[model samples]
Target: MSGTTRSGIPLADVYTAADVTAEPAPPGTAPYTRGISPGGYNDRMWVMGQYGGFGSAAETNARFKRLLDQGQTGFSVALDLPTQLGLDSDDPRALGEVGRVGVPIDSLADFETLFDGIPLSQVKQIRTTANSIGPLWVALVTAFAEKRGTDPNDIAIFIQNDVLKEYVARGTQIFPPEAGLRMAADVVEHTAAHLPNWTPMALSSYHIRESGADAAQEVSMTLSNTVAYLDEVVRRGVDIDQFADKLFMFLSAGMDLLEEVAKFRAARTAWSRLLESRYHAGADARALQIFSYTAGSSLTAQSPHTNIVRVTIEALAAVLGGVQTLNTSSYDEALGTPTLESVTLALRTQQVLAEETSLAKVADPLGGSYVVESLTGQILARVEADMDVIAEHGGALRCIESGWFAERLSQQAYEDQQNVESGARRVLGVNCFIDDSTIEVPAFSVDPSAEEQQRKRIAQTRADRDQSEVDVALDEVRRAARHGENCIGSITAAVRVYATVGEIYGVLREVHGPYTAHTGLG
Candidate 1:
């Protein structure tokens, strides 16, 4: 039967070698079309990086330890809205939101509490998604490292510090586009010089996809943002090879199984060629390493129990797509923050896929299929065309500032909703199958006292710290910001003195001024 992929690429019924023109490179070779590693999971299985964090520091710490005990190799942190917005939990704007969506962190003390007894050396990696206040998070992490007597260069820390995507899709942005780009570039430069094991920026397409871009638009927009970041950092005088290998990419594994797999393969080859042609990057610098999160938008609230099956299929697609790390969403994601029971099921989903299915035994298992190969070629071509449109608008930043990117994504999202409502697209439990049975899954709730407790702690922390030293360090931060120097060193110094996130951000806001956009960009 003939059909079309989710990105609207037509699929043929059958296939043969005659349909394939250019042969794929062997696994572990340059361009990395077949796969990044020759043995794939046979050499080493992908990291089971589960994204989690909520409530108070102690509660989040307990959750982290539980996941580690359950064979989770890496941990991904989700900071609350206040922390991501560079506000203290006690701020008037942060009152109701503190610890509501994720963990509330106001200073280095909270970072220590969040990590508590977990040895940084043993944890494979700690991935955090913090855009506007990423530098603050990095400083807090560095301070935590110093206190633990661990070398900062020895730990694997990955920060999603891409502010450009914030403008296009997500909305946690603090500074204007230019100032935000400067902040991102400063972190990149600082990490390249000091932290050899840290990936300073994870160019993320996950948020874009969650924002409702189709697969082709997702890849194109992400690559365009990458180009913008590279151009900014290159102008800052850093060599391409020095920080290129340290950069990682994050994408979403949606429910369209074959389309998601093909998108990943196409992304690898396209990124390799872009690096070589545009930046003259070498072999090692051209490798496209990816960490994927299962699409949160695909979950259905109609029958929350069925989300377990959805997560399983999405996780399988990520594995087949050759993702370096995978995160599966909990079954109760559409209902609320995942309960411990749901989180356990999500982690078990990965284990079942890795150990029971035997899918990881070979690299690029579907490499020779005519349908897969054709889909990969089609995705690449469409992505290139969309990228060309971005170039016409003066690149990703320009498209964002002009509202073109946001407008396009909104249009696509509207179209998708209309498709489901009109029965043009079938969303199993949501639109297609009518279910009258009421199956109730337990909902996860944050502590009602969490906000009050967090506020008291912040107040006590401020009263206990040396106020004069905080003033001195904050002055240095303002000086660095005013003088166009890399602010990371100064921020790290301020964090060591126990400067709160809001305090440091206050100085930056005074110096850089708050970003004002008229285009509804964020």
Candidate 2:
């Protein structure tokens, strides 16, 4: 290779054991650079998850059944902008946005409808893209389990509760950073004590990567954010060993085969070392649960069929990288929400890898390669250097508050785009391949009635619910938010009364106020 990798790491012509800087180790050992599981996919294939959800709850529920019927090992739900912001479908702010991006959940009734006919224990795990309303989502899940007469301990939930990323990457943050961190930690504390099978949060680098962070920046920023969360939770009396194992990671699997695999190994090395050094967490706590989604940013609009090949490469990278779970992107995602055909094909892509190919039979098949091992050490050094900058700037929280973090990412994003536009980088079908004809593919769209139906459903729920009970429940939530207490219990009480998602968050808004974005630190 003559040029640099996507993250700007130089590629060497030839490599040997001497080129590798990091010490070699076997699978399932300390630092975990080679791999996490000794048996790897032979012990069990990485959990195959397909992420999807859009339109009304009933519509989303039917889609969930489709994935379940297809033998999806895990289910991942993508909530709409309104629900992610904790707004009801009827709210004026949600008028044009209800069910636009993903499923709209306004009340507990909508939640039940979202998973109707699908049992809580149907999949190995169920995950959601809930940040600002993460605790409320967990509360709804547990309440649903109770209503279905299932033991809460029997189910597993992996929520994307890392709100700090929202502050740095973009918007949709409901509370200020400090308050948001506190609430995110509350979910961890509550889940550790109550739902042992659940993953409180997935420190997410996926969005950061999608927002234009290179591989090294992605891992560094994510780890810095992880440190901030650990400090806050431990201050609240959460024992590190007890809840550290509950930590999960959500990362992007990009098309750089060597770099992606190297990034994965280096991330594990950093995480395992951090836990051992900081809190004296044992092996179990250092072992991370990683859920990966193939990079949607790599999909192209022209010659959409090419995406099938693109996603396959990314998915293979994630597998070879030793991720515990994977979600392959649909080929038609660049055009619109994926159609049933495309979604099924995406699921089949993973099935073919596991069953047909012998890819899953070995543990770290590329572990001994000179190029991969050298790249792994290089990526880790870059990550640590950047992490040192974060620490020097007074940590993740200060960087965000001062807008240094946001500004740095913006500059990096601009530089990355400039490289592509200037022909320094080539994107197949986009820049290099001159395809004049448009290739059409079937695309899925949310139903127009989904919005109106969601509104009426929430209105009906509000009327049918006992007013006095809901009032009491919401008051307690207000009290918890005001008193700096863990809001999970109060949120759960409110969820049981069929309280609207907007209602609970509305009480929180009254206490914490709406969040406004910070301008860059100059």
Expressed as tens digits, the lDDT of each residue in 434-519 for candidate 2 is 68886768678888887888888888998999999999999999998899899999999999999888899999999998887876
The ten-residue window of minimal lDDT in model 1 covers: 513-522
Q: Which stretches of candidate 2 lie over 4 Å from their true place?
A: none
Cα-based lDDT for every prediction: 0.89, 0.88
List the pairs of residues colliding in candidate 2: none
Per-residue lDDT of model 1, residues 137-166, tens digit only: 779888889988888988889999999999
TM agreement with the true structure for every prediction: 0.98, 0.98
